[model samples]
Every structure is written in structure tokens, then in C-alpha cells.
Target: MDRSKYTILVADDEELLRWSIKEIVSRKGYRVVVAANGREALEVYHRDHPDLSLLDIQMPELTGMEVLKQIMAEEPQALVVMISAYGQVERAVAACRLGAQDFVCKPFDNDDLLRRIERILEPVRLRHQVEGLLADQRQRYAIDQIVGQSESLREVFTLIRKVAATPNTTVLITGESGTGKDLVAKVIHHQSARAEQPMVEINCAAIPEHLLESELFGHEKGSFTGAGERKLGLVERANGGTLFLDEVGDMALDLQAKLLRLLENRTIRRVGGVDDLGVDLRVIAATNRDLSKRVEEGAFRADLYYRLNVLPIRLPALRERHGDAPLLVRFFLDRLNREMGKQVRTIGEDALACLSAYAWPGNVRELKNVIERAHILADGERIEVSDLPAEVRGGGAGGAPAGVATATAFGLPEQGIDLEEVERRLLTDALARTQGNQTQAAALLRLGRDALRYRMKKFGMLE
Candidate 1:
């Protein structure tokens, strides 16, 4: 709606026509730059760099066709419209072949010219908007936003920078849940050459086993009972981009084989289709599970594990990073202030000490959640010790543990506690929450039913 920035170039031999076009365009708040001849038109073009140009076909010194050709050669993206008399249809065709966008005959209507100019500039406006949004996104996820100063974190940052420069090298990130594995994947992708393309993400543990295959590999319209139409798989949709497999350790064995084939052969076959389609992309997988352990247990394939581990990156849990608590706290506080529309600007030393003392079982994720909770609880500009959860005070009696996780993850207190006792309690809690449904409880605990049963049987709690 703001037309002030749009500049139009009106080049014509006839004085009246040139002034007419200029007056009509300038009234719409667009800046108008005019040239009396073709020779001067190219000069004005080089000087002003107009958004759109209207040229007279018959001009002294050079023809409109010559000017259009030279401009197209230098700037193929330039928008140009040629002006010709009624009998100059062949010349208009030639102008188009020379890269003119459109042509208007001599004695063109003022309103028609204005409308055409408006239509042509719509694409220019859209291009500007897309560029601006991508710029903001790049700034938002820049490597500096990680917010840490620890040596371990410094090492992780260095690895990220190195691996991001290499395209098509499969990367596997291993760390406890909430260790910012997902964030690191994004940083690698957005920093790489594939940033402009789509970065498709799927959680192998999130989707149900039966449908996940169809979701990843797509399906023909009649592939299965519920499939209504032909669907492009996530893998195909992500061609020339990235497919980030979060919790890839949980993917089915059959799908894992297919994925391995994709990595090796760069081709995918749809669920019920016969033809193999070649795909080009990068795979970045993240998991909280110890894949090597899983490989030993036969739950994951050894060959596939080796393939994915080509460029492995392990993100350390927040507890392992020394003295990053305060920095992370401040980072979340500043961001949460803007999001929650509150002025809780600072955290008292007492509260920060509590955060430091607590084992961040959930790592950076739990810390972020706690900061938001504190921001909501605080009535003043500062978050005091009392604003923190009791577990953060190391009370360990109420609410879920700050970093309380499944069988794979546990928050060990500074003073040692019985590990088996904690596991027994968590199993009981999950079972009770899911109303004694073993499968649902297993999912809630991020464990498979068999794994849950093994723990339950070990404790003689199997009913």
C-alpha cells in the first residue's frame, strides 16, 4: 500500500506522451524518472535503477529493442514494457523475444498503463517480503544465540561450525533429552547451503508404527484403505533440503533398512509404487538413546548405526557444562520478558544459587520452563529464591523432579540417592497416571512396553 518507494522510468520521444505517463505515475506516490530519447533512457536507467521501465519503440540514437536487450543482458530480472505503433506488431514480438515483459501500443490509455505497472510490481513486493523474513530467521537462529561460555560448549560450537560447512554428510547428535540436540540440528541446517530449502522434521517415536512408513515414504492413492489420494512423502518433499529425524533410534527396523538404502543409493520407493525416484538431501538424526548400546541389544542395526554415525556430535547435558546456568537464565529471562509481556528483568543471587545447586535433569529445556514459571510467579522486577520450584531448592519432595526423566535419564542428587528406589517410584507413578495401562504408561515414560515390563518384573510389581 505504500507506493512511495516505487520508482518508474518513462522513456519516450514524444514530449506530450512522456509528460503524460510521468504525471499519472507521480500522482500515485511513485517517483518518476524520464528520458527524452533511447540514448538518454539507458543513462537514466544506470543512474536511477528504476523498478519498471516503459520505452518508446522508435527513438533517435537507438531503438527501444536495443535498450531492452542491453538491460536484459545486464540485469535479467529487470521489468521492461515496450511502446510501439499499431502497425509495429512484428517489432513488439521481437521486443518480447529480447526479454521485454509486456508491450503497450502508442497512444496507450493512462489508466491502462497505471494498472499494468501495478500488476508488474506485485512480484517485486512479494520478493522483498520473502527476503526480509528469511533475513530475520537467519538472525534468530545464528550460532551466537546458543548462550554459553563453557569449554565443553565451546567445543560443541566448534563442531557445529565444521560440520555445517559439509553438505550431504549424515550427522547424528546424541545427548540426553533437552540437551538442545534439536537446536543444534537447526543451527547446522540454517548455517549450511541448504538453509533456503525446506528442513522437514519428524519424531520417530511420536508417530504410530503402522502409519509412520506412509508418512515418510508417501503413498499411491490406493496404497491402503484410508489413503484417499496420492501423497508426496516427507522424504520427497524435502528433496534438495534436509530431513531431520528426531528420536530416530525408535524407527522400525524395516524403515531403518529403507532409510539406509536412501542414504546409500539416494533413491526412495513409495509405499505401493513400483518406480524408484532419486532424491537428493541431507539427513541429521538426533536421539536420547545410546545407539551403540541399542546396536548391541539388536534393537538398532549396526550397519545403519555406522552410516548415521559418520559425523557424530554429542551435546552435553546442562549439568555437565560449568557455570552456564546464570547465562542461560539471563537469556531465557530476556526472551520470556518479551514473550510474556512482563518486566521481570533480573533474578536475585539467592534464586540463581538455587538454580545452580539443582540438577537440571531436563537440561536446558527444564531451565527454560522454570524461568517462565518464575516470571509468571514474580510480582516485582526480580525473581527471588521463593519464586523457584521446591525441587530447585533441592527439597526433592514435590512436583516432578526438574530433570526427572524415563529409565534412560535420571536426575541424581548431589548427595547420592538409591537409583533403584527412584526407578521403582517412577514406574509406580507412570502406571498410576495411566490407570494401570502398561502400554500407555510405557509411552508416558518414553519406554517401550517390553522395557517397562522388564522393570516392573524386576521390582515384583507385575500384576
Candidate 2:
């Protein structure tokens, strides 16, 4: 926006000519620095790193051609316009071959000079803007190198673009454990309008029933026993940003009423505080639970359910996303080798078959852990079936065979089958593995803690 702030370096041997050029460009809202010779121009160029450079062809120590070559070598895309006297047309032509943008003859019209400079700089300015935009986009979508080439991931990409454009809407993401729901939430927050603000997450089932309320809506000083000082709740701290409720279904019935009130009123009253404080935040709630079933069973509040389910997004389970298993396994293997400083390369055909054949009950998280375990214990570049955990390698009651049968047996199937029964078993297994740690269970299951709770209710398997 500040055109005058853009720096330009003018290099010419004649002091009068340099002064004239500097004055002309400076008047047109550009900062100008003058150098008496090419040697001095290179020094000033290094010091200032000016946006554009104007070099006189003939100089004392270093000729304009020499400076142009050095500058181009340093930055292949350096923007430099060569200047020559009336009879040095041949020299100017030679400068162009050496990466000079355009040649300006001596005693040239100032208007033509200005027009030429603008013409030369326009493309650079456009490229810089485009690159900045692309960098921002990459930062927004990237999630720790969780690469994907499947149609399922492509659909997720489309959903991300749509959701990012409307940051304020409440999003409900449903998926089996290990399906990357948290990763999706992070991508949405990173790309949203409130990216600069904080993203506060609360595990609804992690906190005790009595403490969950205070965790969400802070207690006032002296409001409760041992409430020594005033505290800000997760919702209040996430003001003007995003609040990710990971296990909303685990929230006590009393707290659910309060949460609904806050979502509706957009305000909170800290414990013992009288006045309500307003907040502006986007709510992204995830659960492995079936909210509709919970509502039907009179478990979760219907009003709150509808309020949170503004835009629904269901992530595909790993087993359902055909052909992505091998890609994921390789990605995890590469990550494992880099972190552990190993040279492990390929998964043996037997190992690859076993991986592809086994149901990834743990989802991506389980898959990653399995690969890490294998890489650490593997004897060579290729991991054999022996490297895998016994349960996964055996492919039996310990672990179901790969694909639909295994996914169903592990209760990871999201739809088409007995969806409720599948989710119920899945959440139950995740909870058992984590030893009732809803947070860890959610991580293992790749569902939000809240999502796991919903699934529990749908299957009547609440912990």
C-alpha cells in the first residue's frame, strides 16, 4: 500500500546523472539510493536489497555487465535495467544477454523511463503476491505431512475449502476412531478468519462431573471452596477464536443445559459473577457418537444437538478408503525412519499384505504406532510379517483379517451395516485400550472425546 516505501537503487558513474534519475524516481513515490559506480552499486545492493536496480553500463572497477552477472548469479530473477550512452547500443544488447531486463539509452525522456520501469516491475509484484497467497494456503491445509491421494481425502479437501470460507459456522465432524477428526479441526481453524486467535479445546469426559462446569465456565474467586482466585473458562479464553469440544456427549446433563444457553446467548457468567460477558467464537464439535440415537433415547439434548450440527462432515474410515492403506503405511514408515535415525525402506510383500489385509481398528493413529513399532524392531530396510505385532500379524480373533470383515469385527464400519453396533464396539474397544482415558481413547479412535460419547450412547456402551 505504501508505494513510496518501496526502495529502488540507481547505479551510474556520473554524479549528475545519478542525482537526476534518483530525483525523477523519488518524485513518483519510490525510495531511491544512488551509487557512483558499479562497485559501489553492488555494496549498496547487498546492504539495501532494493526491489529494483538501474545499472549504468560503463563503470570504474566493475562494469554494468559484471555487476549484472553477479547479481543474476545471486538471484536468478533479479530485476535490473541496464543504462547506456547513445553510442553504446551494442553494449546494451550484450547486457541483455547477461540477464539485464531492458536497456535505457542516455538522455532518455523521463516519461519513457517511468513507463519502462513500471512495465518491468509489474510481473515481479504480481508474482510476489501470488506466492504469498500460495504459502498461506499451504500452511492452512498441511497437517504434519498426513498425505492423501484417495477420493475420500479429495472430498475432505473440498469440505475444508467450503468450511474455511465461513469460519463462524458450527461444524459437526463424525468419524470412526483414527480417522483424523482433530487434524481436520486444526486445518479449519488455521484457514478460518480467526486464525490469529487461540483454539481452546475441552475434553468433556476427561474432567469429573463436578469440575467440568468450572472448566468450561470459570469459577469466580471465593465462589466455591478452594476457589482462591478468579479464573477464565475455556470458552471465555477462546473468545473471538474457536472452542473445540471433543467429547460433548460426555458433558453432564446440567452442563449441557448451560452449554446450550451459552451457544444461544453468546455470553457467559463466571461462577459467582453476576454480569454476563459476551464472546465471539466458532464452535467445532466432534464425536464418534450417534447424536440422533442419543436424542431419540432422551440422552443428549435435541435443541443443543441441532444447534451444534450446523454443517455436518463425516470422515471416511481407513478400511473404507480403498488403496490408501499402503500409502499411509509408507508415510508412517518414512516418518519413523527419520525420527528414529533408521534406514528402513520398504515393507516386505508379506508385511505389506499383512498390513493391507489386517483391519486397522486403531485407524491412522494405530497405523502410525504399528509402523513405529515395526521400524524400531525391523532387521533391515524391508519389514517382514514377523516385525508386526503378534495380534496384527496373526490375523485372527486377536485381530480380524484385513478389510470389511476386520473393520466390522473391530466395529469401525461407519455405515451400511449395523452402524450403532459397530460404533458401540469401536468406542468400547478404544475406551478399554486407553483404560477409560477419554482423551487418549479419542486419540486412538481418531474421534473427538465428545464423538466417542455419542457413539457410546447410540450403542448403549457408555463408560
Candidate 3:
């Protein structure tokens, strides 16, 4: 409400009316500028760029409608208020449709005009506040803000940078749970040209199947039970921005078809609505599941998978990103030090070794959680071996990660090994590696799919 920070432009052919308007607004502490006609109004507009413009409907050189059109074309969000005479109300309504934010009548009361301006600028103030918050978020989740330096992580960073430069390509981020897929999505959005706009996210797995279509495409009044009014969906809300679909592999089969149509046509029909609403959307789809495997299993649609996979980014598991544990540990410790008000300066070598050796099945999130627990449990100024959990202390001694025993460690019996059990173990390992995709498992075992399936059936492994 600091009126001094806001400037108003008063454009009228009548010099006396312009001066009177300036006096009225300037008395309220607003910085006021005046213009004699439509042509001069544009000059002042392009030059000073006032926060608001009050234009008279009838003006010399150019009509108010003409000025409105040019201004809107140049700056669509420009705040404009048309001044209309008694007979010019129709023109004022037309001006509203032409992108003027609001319209006021000639001989309008000084107080009423101020009130109208106040109401209009209030929403603008809210929007500015939202934009300021987004600025802070952009700094926090900036592209390079991800904390890691391993070679595998470097590749992901390179892809994120390349993908962010694209204007609006569909992006598919694949990674295990807790591997920061969602964070990568946010980083890409905030680093792109659409940073100033929104990045709306929805977890496809979390929403019920019955309501997901309604949530994504909205519904008209009386479209369904409890449908009382027309509603805009998430796609409409994110029309000018990004829509992040997390766990997209879990989306229902029926919805997958609708989503495919949306991607192909760039339009969506609200449930029970007759017309298709066009949308400009940058879809960033993410999944912890292996979508190729899902497609092979017929649980996910192949065409939709291909559409979403336009620009793919696969995040490596923490254990796969060799030499990153130390860096991540240091980063998390620094943050924990400030957060917990603890002064643990350094971790013992024994503790760091255990962290690096243990297979991070839960990935980076697990590491962060472990670090937090250590910060709380460390007795002295530094973290020692005793501060670590038992699993970390006993893991990774023989080059194999925790909980995974080597074949040599599971040594062949002195008498003899059971050939049947060995075959069963190999079959299970191959299936696990390929997430139950028969063709892929076959390739891994260097056997045909028929042979693999026959063996799996013999062992009661096939459903």
C-alpha cells in the first residue's frame, strides 16, 4: 500500500480533465503522469511504464481501443482502466474484453476510482508476492544446487542442463525411490525459460483412479454426483507452465489413453464437457518403476511411454555414484550442523569408510537420514565409528555391499554343490535384474525367452 511506489498514467485530450485527474491521484500520494491524447499516452507508456493507465474512450489521433490493442500486444499483463462517457459504456465493456483490467466511468467519484484501483492492484500485489517466493525457490533448487561430484552424477547434471535449455519438450525422469527424481524435475523447471511461471506436480500413484480424470481434466456443473459447479483442472491451471506427473507409471490404463491424447493433440476435454480446451504444457513425467518393463508386462501403454520419453534423464542410485558419499556426507553434515546446533567438525575415517562401503539401498535419502542420526548420537565434537549403525559398521569389508553375499563367500560345498539350487538362484538373479521382464531376463542369461520361461515354469517361478 505504499502509493509512492505506484505510478498512474492519466491520458485525456482535455487538458483540464487530465490536470484534475492528476491532482486527485497525486493527492493520494501516487506519482501521476499526464498525456494530452492517445498518441502521447503510448509514448508515456513505452517510456515511463506506469503501474496503471487510465485511458479515455474517445481521444484524438487514435481511439482508446487502438491504444489498448497495441499496449496489450506488447505487454499482455499491463494494468489498464478505461474511462468511458455515459454512452461509451459499451465501448468500455469492449475494452475489458480487449485486455483492459478494469473500466471506470466519466464523472466517476474520486473515492470510487481509488477504491477500484485498490481492488485491482491488490491481486497484482498478491501475484508479486508469489513471484518473490518463486525467486527464492529458484535459488535454493538451482540446477547446480544438487550436491554430488561423482562421474555418474556428472552425466545427470549435463543432461539436466541440456534439457532445461529446451523450451517445452516432454521430459521423463527415471530413478529409484529416494533418488531425487522430484528434485531434478524442480531444478529443470526453475532453470528453464518458464521459471517465472508455475511447476504444478501431482503424484499419479497417490490419487484414486475414480477422481484422477476429474482432477486432471476438470468437470462441468452436473457432470457427476456432487458436481455443483464448473471447475478448472490441474492441466488448465498449468496451461502456461509445467505439469510434473510423478509416479506416472502407476497411472491407470484408461487414464493413460486420455493422457496420450492430451500429449498428441495439446488439448483436453473436461469430463462431460463438449469442447476441447487447448493447453500449452511442458509435461515432466517421472517414475521409480522401470517403465520399459512395465510396458513389456502390458501394465503401461507403449505409445504413452514413448511420448513421455522425449527427453529422458535417468538418475543414478547413490551407491552407483562412486566417490559421492564423502561429498554428500560433508554437505549433509554442514546443513545438519546449522540445523541441529551441533558442532561435529569431522567424521572419523572409520565412519566415512563404512558410509562409502555400505550399499545405499534407500539411496541419498537413506544417507541423509543416517547422517542426521549420527549428528544426534555423536558424543564428542567429531563423529566416530561408534556413532554409526551396526549395519554400516559390518558392511562392505569384502568389496561386496552390505546384505549381499559373494558367490565365493557362499562357497561350494566340499562334497558337492546342488546343481538344481544353483540354476534356481541364477534364474532368480536374472529375473530380479530385469524386474520380471522375460525377454530381458532371457538376454541376461544368454538364453531364448522360451528356454527362460520353461526353466522358470519348472522351478515354479512363473505365474
Candidate 4:
């Protein structure tokens, strides 16, 4: 809207027409640069880097179409409007195809010309605004946001740095449901060459099987009963960027084959379309499911597994990264304070110890949620143990009764007992209490099912 900051370049073979256009636009407070031909237009464009250009279809030294092509080659995003006589409308349309923003006829009114210019500049202005917002987000979600000082987390940070620098390596991120797999995928994309482009995401397990294919590979109009218009699939939209497939292990076998084909050939055909369209994008697939076990069970394709496992990055569960809970608690507390408009600056040491001692079934996401809840409930400047969740404060499975001596259920001896034997007994008791349901047992133990399974296997309790 501030025209004084923008400059316009006007190029035409007729000196009178060039001066007339410059005078009309300059009256609106924009600085005007005049050129007699296409060659001079390019010279002025390269020198001044004007925001917009108006060129006549007929010019000396170089034709307007030739100049448009050269300008686009130099600056793909440059805004240019072509001018033509009534008979040269066809040529003007050709200029539009070569990246001209819009065109005005020779008999065009000054008001009409200015309106067209404003319309063209509006989109450019909005795009720049969106780019600024995205830049801020890129900074916020940088790899440093994956907070932890433990060796396991440090190793994950190292792997992310190494893989993010690569251009097209397919990355498979394996972790528990809430272990920040999505965050890892985003960091890789924002750090890659395709950061400027959109990173399209499709949750393979979230959508129904019947619609998932159509969503991934768009359909043409009339391709299906309800499809009324042609659709661009996520693969096509992510052509120059990255496509993140979350919960990919739950994808159907038939869809897995098609996805494998896309990975192998970099081409996809819509469900009812005949033509195969080529797409170039980096693929990052994530899942909490044990894909290798699924393959062994014939539920998942082995070939597809191998393709996706090329650059596997397995995230460590929260419990595996010991001593990191207090760090995460502080980080979340500080963030929640600002977000929730609370004055709670620090957490009591007893509350911090309770949080660190409890097994986090839902990982960092759950920790953040707990901190937010506590921030809202805290009546004083610091979070106390009373502000924590009942399960955490009570230190029992789903907040067992205070009178129940769950910690001493096995009745430890005066002498120290075997830690592994005690853990094995606890795991067995949790399983028995849950009627052999691993999910419920994991909940009772406040552990992720994957973590619980690992311990079960270690104790020879898994069949």
C-alpha cells in the first residue's frame, strides 16, 4: 500500500507512449524508470531491481516476449505486465505463459491499468508476509527444540543433524506414540534444501482405507461417484518438498505396495486415472508399531520395509533417557508459564522429584500437558507436589489408595534385594492385574507398551 517504497519499470518502443505511462504511474507516488526498448528494460531491471515492470509487445533491440523470457530466467518471481494492441492479444497471452503477471491493451484506460497493477502486487505482498511467519516457525522448531542432555538424546540430535543435511534420503523415524516423531520429521525438512517449499503431511492410519489412496493420489473429475472436480494429491503438492507419512505401519497391504511403487519409481497414478505423474520429493515415514514384527507376520511388505528403513532414526523413550525429566520439567514449566499467563516461575524440588520418579507413559507431550495443568492450578509463585497429577504424587498405578503399600507389596528384606528380580515380579503382577492385556498393564505401570514389551522380553515373560 505504501507506493513510495516501490519502483515501476516502463518499457515501450514509442517514446510518447513510454512517457505517458510513466507519468500516469508516477502521479500515484511510485518512482518510475523509463526505457525505450527491451534491452534497456533488462539493464534498468538488473540495476534498480524495481518491484514491477510494464513492457510493450513491440520493442526495438529485443521483442517483449524475448525480454520476458530472459527476465524470468534471471528472476523467476519477478512481476511483469505486458502491453499490446488489440490485434496483439494473442501475443500478450503468450507473454502471460512466460511468467508475465498481467497485461494491458494499448487502448487501456489509466484507471484500469493501475487497478490491474494493484491486483497483481497484492498476492506478492501477501506471499512475503506468509514467508516471514514461516521463517519464525522454522526458527522455533529447529533441532535445538528437541531438549535433552542425556547421551541417548544427544545421539538422536547427532543423527538428525547428519540426515537433515542430505537432499533426498528417505528417513524412517521409529518411536513410541508420543516421543516427538513428528517434531523430528519437521526439523529434517526445515533443515533440508526443500525448506522453502511446503512439507505436506498425510496420516496414513488416521484416514479410512477406502479414502486413503484417493487422498494420497488425487482423483480426476468423474473418477468416482462423489468426486466432482479434479484433485491434486499430497504427492503432487509435495513435488519439490517433503512428504511425511505418519503411522505408516498401519497402512493396508495394498496401499503399501502402491506406496512402495511411488518410492521406487517416483511416480503415482490416481485411483481411477490412467496417466502416471512423476513427483520428486523426500519421503519421511514414522510409526510406533514394530514394523519388523509386522513384516514377519505377513501383515507388512518386506520390500517396503527395506525401502523405508534406509536411514532409520529410532527415538529413545523418556524413561530410557534418564536424568532428563527434570530438564524437560523446567523447560515445560517456563513455556507453560508464558503461554498460560501464570507467575509460576519455578517448581518445588519435591514436585520435580515426583515427576522424575514417575514413568511417563505418554512421553514429552504428556509432560507438557501436565505442566500446563499444574500452571493453571498453582496458587503460589512455585509449583508444589500438590499441583502434580494424582498418579505422580501418589506414586502408584493409576493412583492406588494411600493405605495400600504397593511399593512394599513384595515385602523387601532388611538386606538389599535383586533389583532385576523385583522388577520382574512387578511386571508380572501388573500383567496379572490387567488380565494379560499389555496396553492396560502398561497403563497400570505408567509405561509405554513398547517399553513394557522390552522389559517383558528381557525377563523371558514374552511369548
- How far out, in Å, is residue 247 in model 2? 1.5
- For residues 1-463, write the lDDT of model 2, one tens digit per residue: 3457478899999989999999999999888988888889999999999888999989989998899999999988888999999899998998898888899999999999999888887876787776676567558556545467776677877887799789889898887778888888888887788786789998887888898888888989999999999999999899999999986766777778888888899988888889898999999998888788789988899999999888988787775566788988888877787888998999888778777766577788888888888898888888988888876776443454444343434544455477666567777787888778776676565454556666777677663
Candidate 3: list runs displaced more than 4 Å. Answer: 1-128, 395-402, 406-463
lDDT of 1 by residue, 1-463 (tens): 5688788899999998889888989999999999998899999999999999999889889888889989999999899999899999799989988888889887788789889889999998888788787778778778998989887789899999998899789999998899898889988888888888889999999999999999899999888998789999999999999999999999999889999999899999999999999998999999999899899999999999999999999887676677788999989988888887889888888787778766676889999999999999998999987788888865543333355443345566789899789889989999999889775586566554567888999999976
Q: What is the C-alpha lDDT of each candidate?
A: 0.87, 0.82, 0.87, 0.87
The TM-score leader among the candidates is 1
TM-score of each candidate structure, all chains considered together: 0.83, 0.59, 0.66, 0.70
Find the 10 residues in a row with the least total lDDT in model 1.
397-406
Global CA lDDT of candidate 3, please?
A: 0.87
Model 3: per-residue Cα lDDT over 70-185, one tens digit each: 99999999999999999999999999999998888878899999898888778777877787798898898897679888766888999998988995899999987889999999
Looking at candidate 2, what is the lDDT of residue 239?
95
| Model 4 error, position 59 (Å) | 19
lDDT, residue 33, candidate 2: 88
> In candidate 4, how many Å is residue 321 off?
2.2
Task: For model 2, state the Cα shift of residue 152 in Å.
Answer: 3.0
